[model samples]
Target: MTNHKLLIVGTVAALAILVAGGAYLSGRSEADRFAQCRTGNVAGGMEAFGTDFTLTRQDGARVTAAEVFTRPSLLYFGYTFCPDVCPMDTARNAEAQALLAGQGSEVQLVFVTVDPRRDTPEVLTTFGEQFSEDIVGLTGSDEEIAAVNKGWRNYYKANDAEDDQYYLVDHMTNTFLVMAGGATAEFFPRDTPAEDMARKVGCFLDAAS
Candidate 1:
């Protein structure tokens, strides 16, 4: 074969590889963009609050964290089907609740489900109440769910091709604190200890009041 022909063939192969590489990279970047993880730089992070939601409690009564707790709010984002992280987060939230209770700190603990397909209103009702009586689980439509996720910068996706199977919600495991007047103040990541969170809440309340 002529050297010129060989060179042309090699160039064609390289171009093909470049194109394939570019496609792969694009897909990977999209995946990473959708991924959500806890904040590590600061001891506590901030909430990306979207539009406020009015949801019914387990008892079929309308409520919001602000309307119910009325003091300060600690919000946890997770789903019911979570095998490990969700339960751990709830337990940690409960621990924080207990710590605050021990200190007589009035803090509202709220749990929001990222995967609402399986974690319907009923699922949320049961899952949240297990941790603490104060814990409330709320549900909304897909659009509302997406809006909340975007507002909070949560990472989650449907696990199955069909809607029957539960979805996997990937979100920053941060407890957002909504101080007085439904304003977001600070947030505690999963790494922070429950005791520290309780203390922070106490301090915030003391300063606010």
Candidate 2:
């Protein structure tokens, strides 16, 4: 009789567990959750806050937003030939990465090429390694670059007259702070202090979790 009772209890527990797990997954997939995340972005409209983008990583591997979708991602748009703004911003991002590491916070850094024409896969892979070990550089065909830029709300322009002599990219200098999973949680503009950037990322990760 004890064996019979034990078997019944175990079966009932398994059924309950399965039912609860299904419900939880269903609730998370509901459109409302993502919709709320999208609506919150419209006031100033955080471009990094939205969902959708996959770029080539610094190691010559393709990275999708889905890969880091559950982690915080700091995104920047620039080209390797950038003389000033890009380097300064990327350096700051590297500092932020170190700060986060010291604080035990998890974050991912992404660098998307604005001058894909010249920032080929080989150049980006080599140049990106010089900035930071954790920074991921991405470059793609012009059409692919344009689609991703629009999705992320990034801006870029090319100069034609002197294009052959010098790099012809003038991209936005702002850095995008994106929370994994939830689109457009917040943003840090160009030159945000490393300490402040780390704090914001911590808060976003905590709240997002």
Candidate 2 has which clashing residue pairs, if any? 49-183, 49-184, 69-181
Model 1 regions lying over 4 Å from their true place = 1-50, 61-69
Candidate lDDT (C-alpha), each: 0.70, 0.73
Lowest-scoring 10 consecutive residues by lDDT in candidate 2?
31-40
Q: Write the per-residue lDDT of candidate 1 for residues 70-153, one digit (tens) a residue.
A: 667787778888889879978887888888888887676777777666767778777877788777676666776676566656
Model 1 earns a TM-score of 0.70
lDDT tens digits by residue: candidate 2, 31-108: 233343231344544533354666676566777777645667788888888888888888888888888888888677
Best by TM-score: 2
What CA RMSD would you report for each candidate?
Answer: 15.7, 7.2
C-alpha positional error of residue 173 in candidate 1 after TM-score superposition, expressed in Å:
1.3
> CA shift at 82, candidate 2, in angstroms?
0.2
Worst 10 residues of 1 by lDDT: 34-43
